[model samples]
Target: MFDIDRWREIFQSINKNRLRSILSGFTVAFAILLFTLLFGIVSGLSNSFKSAFADDAQNAMFVRVWQTSKPYKGLQTGRTIQLKNDDFNYVKDEYESKIQYQSARIYKNFTLKYKNEANSYSVRAVHPDHQFLEKTMIDEGRYLNEKDLQEKSKVIVIGRLIKADLFGEKPALGKRINVNGSSYLVIGIFSDEGGDNEERLAYIPVTTAQMIYGNNDYISQINLGYNPDLNLDEAISFGKQLERDLRFKLNIHPDDQSALSVRNMAEANKNVGSFMAILYAIVILVGSGTLIAGIIGISNIMIFVIKERTKEFGIRKALGAQPLSIVWMVVQESVFITTIAGYLGLSLGTYLLSLIGDSLEEDYFIKDPSVSTGIVVGATVVLILSGLIAGYIPAKRAANIKPIEALRAD
Candidate 1:
């Protein structure tokens, strides 16, 4: 019900003790602001971590061969394990249906030149499907295609940094650059926030890389993207199986020391998730501490308000006002004051977060710090509860005071 009289009475009472009311309200407001800011910070940190690993496809896994730890079956332990072209072909053939995308890469650092302009940078030799695993973006021209791989064409794609260094903002596509003294045409430029600068590095067909780099049939690593819908555990099992089968077919010891390494995006996601949970827990602890201090301050101010309003309470009782009505009056005043002040603090906090969020870089843990609508609502509810609790004890004491005694008190 709309109670004009009740509002008027509450306003009059608050106006009589403006300083005390303001102080109490400020406490709740500060708590809400601090809590919300902490939540935003934690959320931002988690988001940044997730973004850093976004280049890799979800549920993707990487596999590379190294030396073995122990002798497996009849193979020697110290033998070096290398991934051969045949092994990659076997994996592709055996697990073609289960795989989403797969690519083998041979990478090395070499100096690239265009006329007299030369820069030493890393180069990768990859298959057509390598683009899928790389999350590559082509800034100009086109990426490697199946035809390029099959023909062992001297076509190359460069990273943005590579392009900028070699071509200086000029179009790099269709230009020929010499890598390790051999000329290759630039077919595309790869661009990303944090990736191999396409301008600085060159990418070529895996076969070409083998021919130029002297590796012949050797590959450094194989990257595979799995369907996200598949169970992570099952995917991991499938990867292990591929590893075992590849090692067996390659005449490499299964337990060859440093023989093989596998990295899975699903596992990374799980680890990141665990890290976020811990970060949020710390944020909550700190925010809760701040909230507790604010609540105590509000409670103290409410106690003072009750003491100052003893005479008013007595006068109301003398006029036959119910005990619950007196309680409601005090409780409403606390709620109104805290709610307004808390909202002001919340707005300020949000504004600050917005102003600085975009400028946040990857080097720092924090990123876009914005609280969700649910967090805002939850904070508002918490403020309301704090106000109610702060007013409760004082309101109860006022209600119990004998009208005669309160009226007599100076």
Candidate 2:
């Protein structure tokens, strides 16, 4: 219901105590602003950390050769631990049936030349099965196949960044690019969520890399992923077993510091989850503390407002105004102030978040930083609730004033 007279009364009250009302409103606005910014930063960092695992297979782990750090039986310290084709075959023969994807890469520094332009890139020789393991997405053309590996084809797949740098806007597929003066047909252009470094590397058949770069069955690293159908517990168990199996097969010590390095993404995610949980708790605690201070500020101001309006409330009561109406008036004014201030804070916070989100480059640690709609809505509800609760006691005090006591006031 539109109550012009009631609105006029509320405006009169605000106008009379302008400085006090402004201070109260500013407190609420500043509190919400602080809370929202802190939360958005935390949320952005969380998203950035999660982005690292994007498009990657579940329970995937990578293994690389590591030199011995401690001396053991018949092995001296500082000896380089080499992983070759036989070691790879041994692991595959034992675990191939249970493995979802397994691959090894032969990496070398190679210069790629096209049309008189030369650039150095990480030219890696990879198996046909390595595509799925790396979560490689072919934007155009095709990735290396089994046939390419068998025939040791001189074909290379470049990243989008490489394509932009090397080929410009022209089509690159089927074009022969020189790798150290050897021609390799551009068979594919691929993209990955693993960021620009992963994208910038050029890929060729693993066998070709071994023939050209490696004298024997030398491999740089081995990668594996669990079957998709496996449950989380099953996947974790198999990953552990595979780690042990590989170490045992390689004759590496159980406590060897550098015999091998296995990066278990599933375990990393679990640790990240724990860290994020702590972060969430910290955000909530800090936000709640600021919110409480704002609520207290509002309640203090409302108490003063009620005291100032004591005579007015009494006169209204004597004039047959309902006690409930007086309470509603007080509560409504408090709600209006807090709601307006909170909305301003929320708008400014979200605007800042949008700006930061657009400008920030996504990395392994932090991505787009912003609060969800639910958090905004929740904050709004808190604002309204804080107003009502802050006003309730003072409203009751105002309503309890007898007309006789009010009339006696000078």
* TM-scores for candidates 1 onward, in order: 0.78, 0.83
For candidate 1, the per-residue lDDT at 130 reads 77
Give per-residue CA lDDT, model 2, range 1-410, as digits (tens).
98999889988988898998899888888888878888888888888777767756656778887787877777787778887888778778887766777888877888898996789999888887788988899999999998998898899999988898888999888899999879999999999988988889899988888887645788988888766677656666777787787777776777885878777776777778788889889888887887778778888988888877788888999999999999999998888889988888888988888877756644324477888989989988999998998788889888999998987765
State each model's CA lDDT, in order. Answer: 0.80, 0.83
Q: Kindly give the number of clashing pairs for every candidate.
A: 25, 1
